[model samples]
Target: MSTSAPPDAPPALRARHLRKQFPGVVANEDVSLTLRAGTVHAIVGENGAGKSTLMKLLYGMHRPDSGEIHLDGEPVRFTSPREAIAAGLGMVHQHFMLADNLSVLENVVLGAEPGRAGVLDLPAATRRVEELCANLGVRVHPHAETGGLSVADRQRVEIVKALYRGARILILDEPTAVLVPQEVERLFVSLDRLRTRGLSILFISHKLDEVLAVADDVTVIRRGVTVADSLQANEVSSRELAHLMIGAELVRTERPAHPADQTARRVALGLEEVSLRLSDGRQALDAVCLDVGEGEVVGIAGVEGNGQTELIECAAGLRRPDHGTLTLFGRNITGTTLRRRRADGVALVPEDRHRQALLLEAPVWENRMLGRQSAPPNSRRGWLTRRAARRDTEHLMRDYDVRARDADVAAASLSGGNQQKLVIGRELAAEPKVLLAAHPTRGVDIAAQQQIWRRIEEAAAAGAGVLLVSADLDELLSRSDRLLVMLRGRIVAQVDPRRTSTEELGVAMSGAGESAR
Candidate 1:
């Protein structure tokens, strides 16, 4: 492990011969990367290819078994994330980490509150945060509560928090995954402003098109090692990069054509004026009415925090709506348990796989066996069937392209995208009549995304109704026959995807004008 760059005018950050080994997996093996000063550098790879591992090593979440990290031409070792931050490095995680009850100003200056003589200086902290936001062209109120802000606004607060701490090098992981197309454009604009001010950015994303669009240099890693390093961003196309990632040509995604006869099929899922009151007494959903026929895909498009979670919970039987009715295949299931809903051929793919869908510490087989304990193969007469569960897990791992050494591996060891695949695979294997897919392809690689979409289409073709909730406009526009727009806990507009544009959908989502309900 040695630095390759010349000592004069050292790079902002560099890693040489980095290696990290887990129990049964080598997360990174002899990986090296360099980020020049004042540039946006991107790392791209398929899921479970050690992209997150490498970033964690750099961020000091995990120490490499063997490697040398260099900052400004000097060897360095960080014992914790705090040391990394003190060294002018900051990381914005894929999932935001702000406290919901706190205000924007408090969240920004949480660890580094300004004070004198044990007295907190609120006005000074607010002024500094406001200045940082103004510099970055982000619009956010310091007094506003974190829980009520939109996803895009919360992301801006994260970025401003990093800048407020005097970070010279920033790490952003999958920043645009939850944002609409318009919000992505705004993020790129802020990144450009930061880059011009001599800040170095390390961007980790599964989206090739976005990497190519925003990065100054691109690096590709495969199988826990660097295959391509410091390639000029303009020299490679997304197609070539995709091929390098998976060792094959990229698969194109096209929506399957719905049968004309299926248009009048039985309703698999129906919501009549569904309204919900959250535990915190918020009106999360209000008078939401929708229906998905058998063999049809109905998409819901909205900015995050706009009643999607409540709607999914209502459909999945995780929560009982305060008013209105929910029906599964013409059966009213408003008062049923979650297990009973699943027994009635209802399956759900939750938005946050780690929180709602997976047992992180459990083995893959055990995780696959969850929620089906009362059914055949998984269990019989309340007795577990280990052999049958193992067989099914192996098949799902192979079919879903979940990269892992074996079914005995812990679910937490796999990458985010792989975890998502396992959750979806388990739900789909039940052959449910109705599927609740919330951000199904949010963090997955291109190859896995295509596979997931194909499976959804196949399920719909097999007479399963799908409620597709996604922030990706293209995903909704292409896969959905009818698109519903939600704003402020209400369904404001319903548009035909074939005739709608992204701009029009964005307008409807933002509630910029009167609704055409």
Candidate 2:
């Protein structure tokens, strides 16, 4: 399929010699980019390559150190996000910005609510949202509470909110990081429709295949500089794109599992007859069973909200399963507390890094010391040793290659990739026997993703049984020795990762395959 955007369109947005600098990092240095109307322009690069920083500058979240921004034929400068929005620019952040307590309509129209005489015009706002949804082919219930909706639904709400604000150019950051194959297709369809309506989109993604599939043009950035711009997607292959982004060959080495090596290794983690019921009485998990042996990497592949989160929570001791038997290292831990599980050597790289893994407002040192500050040399007699913590934080920062101004900087201030590295570093430093990694590499750049995969393999080689839950089929299949397909809270099939096709996995993930127990 041809990946290049239509060639004859005029430029809708343009940036010239953009520059941004933090304390120790020149985020963007003489970067230039142009977006054509009715096209999907993709920005591709490694974490800390200044892709996000450039986007932030364009969106008015951060003012450029030196740059010229032009909308259509007029030069412009935005001091804040509100000014950018007023100028027909909208940005859907990598992390969601919706209030869970609010209804979908309320979330879409937040801060710009329709009202008269201090009374909210709920009906009017809802009708407008309905019309917008229909026009964009965005499926969402306006009256539904945001908390009750799935990740994909929330993403749709974000899109609707941007369009509601009269945005002509939309920026989507890592839009497909959490979506399943089917949901990704639906999203692409919506983007295509929007393009047809003359909307320009700046799509940022780490997945090369997705970029090739939807992007009209591809831009590659390296070390805060634009290396390649407006490359026709069809003119280059995914492998070539990976090479361009990393400035080197990204070799995918595969190792065949030796069948004779599979012995009666001690069961490190076990789940039997696990069942969970939602608050609305819907069964999220239904008698699912799985086992992980020492030194084994068991991969769980499924679409988002298909009981993967519930199962992981049950195993992590975060949520009590209604009916299940969970064992860790031969000890029953079904009803155990999360702290107890942690003390028992259970480590987790949570799905939502910002919300569940790291404390955004806390300094990098504090986030690094979390869950392990009370152990060994860092704590004595219930008092945390600040010196020891700082030293350890420095070690992790250096070891993990986490780019930050300083250890004292707030976790939220770091880029998404750097935050992920910090989370992985902290969790892996504990050296637990059993590790639960959920979406461990989401939104990470190619180099970071490679590093994370290597770390997972290293942990498995060192005898730590790993359970990997991910939406990226290639990541799960390529790294894991065995793959278990989850559908509607049950294991539908088990297959050798090396042999399964993306098509077959998609079938299993969507519950469209022949019945197999």
Candidate 3:
């Protein structure tokens, strides 16, 4: 029923009436889209709107209940990811899946290695990786340790890894979520090169302008159904696309005015000459000095790995600074443990929620009891009262608008945006005086972003000092009272977010402009 393909030439990939259902949920229903050869086709939708489900069906992560997938005009059924890969398909997840300790070449040839009699063919694999990287215009050090590369380079490596596996059609998920503006442009260039070389790309992202900029055609899906497809990217505005995404016009949340009386504010959290070193002996925080005032939102803008993680960890007592003084409400707490810090009204929504925040296999109620396990309403006399925890979890779910089957459901069952909301709800429930929020709304939909921003604003309006770190320049500029840019582990520049633009802030973040040094 899918036209199958144009009679003369075949599309790269096509899905028709795809329906996938999970326990207690219909993830995808009546979904259809086509990826033409040698084009960047974008798929845009809200979180839990069937985009991921459709991608999984295409990539063979999950089989569709009732659908037809035609590859290059030939009907195909992929039983697993291996089959998909064998048929010229590859998927790069939002999180990069490379071991830090391994070399780029090693990670690329890991599972699908060419060998003779159980011995690896290192020379042939290296040649193939280099050839693929060159063809795709990917600039990466194949022999270098994957950990030492920048986020952008690592992403390119992922792309090369996919190509090395003989992928002609690539699926990129939230590829720009972690990149700064400059790096984003670089990635766009690489995608263009790939497209020109006849590789199809199915781009998925919540960033509308980006989709409009790079995609040749756009598809919109909503609530397990496809409402629009094959719309020319140059013909439609982002606002119109957003309306299609959520089935209505998007409403911007009203933000509280930035506190004007800066001189009258009290120092809620202070870091004085904070210095920390990674286990690899890199200077993670080079004499960084910062302060957050009560009732103020101070935003930090930085490329990831430039001390943002270490600074937040130091504040939350997850890492010990080699030399520094951390003060909470004018009291030094450099030696405080994480539990004691949580008990004293300090909380964090970590950057990588899966690795640093949640216990994926655990029930929702237990995850809600994570950081604030010792706080009131969920704990009593050195023990967690399960009933109290479940009751609060239920309330938090409603309050934060987290979508899940039930409080007893596993946290892993929810979508990424819902998982993020769950983490934010749990941290904010404690009513902490000092809040360390990193990438608070990194990869959520517009509606969920509004809710999360509203909650953060509410917390700050109630006199909590918010130190927000995010790669999203717009979020930082719109939410922060003052913005500080980090470069090579140091606070190199401070800009007035109300006056400065994202481009200017991006220049500052990369240490290329506006320091006035």
What is the lDDT of every predicted structure here? 0.89, 0.88, 0.89
Off by over 4 Å in 1: 1-8, 259-263, 512-514
Q: Which stretches of model 3 miss by more than 4 angstroms?
A: 1-7, 254-256, 374-376, 380-384, 514-517
Compose the digit string of candidate 2's lDDT tens values, residues 1-517: 2233456645789998899998767889978888987789999999888998999899898999888999975899999999999999999988889999999998999888889887889889989999999977977889899988888889999999999999889999999998878889989999998888888999999999999999989999988888889898879888988888889999875434746567778889999999999887878899999999888889999878788988888899889999989999788999899999998888999999877988999999999988777886578899998888888898899999998888898998788999999999888888888999999999998789988877777788888889999988888888787789888888888988888887788888878752865
Comparing 2 and 3 by TM-score, which wins?
A: 3
Cα lDDT, model 2, residue 149:
88
Residues 1-517, candidate 3: write the lDDT tens digits: 1122344678899999999988888999899998898889999998889888898899998999998999998999999999999999999999999999999999999998999988899899989998988876776767999988988888889999999889989999999999999889989998988887788899999999999999999999998898998899999999999899888888876555664668888899999999998887899999989999998899999888888988899999999899989999899999989989988898799999999989999999999988667766778998878998898899999998888878998988888999999999988888889899999988898888988988888889888999999999999999998889888889988888878998988888877853542
Give candidate 2's error at residue 446 in angstroms: 1.4
Candidate 3: lDDT over CA atoms? 0.89
The C-alpha stretches of model 2 lying farther than 4 A from their native spots are: 1-10, 114-124, 255-261, 380-382
Q: State the lDDT at 471 in candidate 2.
A: 87
TM-score of every prediction relative to native: 0.95, 0.93, 0.96
Q: Residue 18: error of model 2 in Å?
A: 1.4
Clashing pairs in 1: none
By TM-score, the best candidate is 3
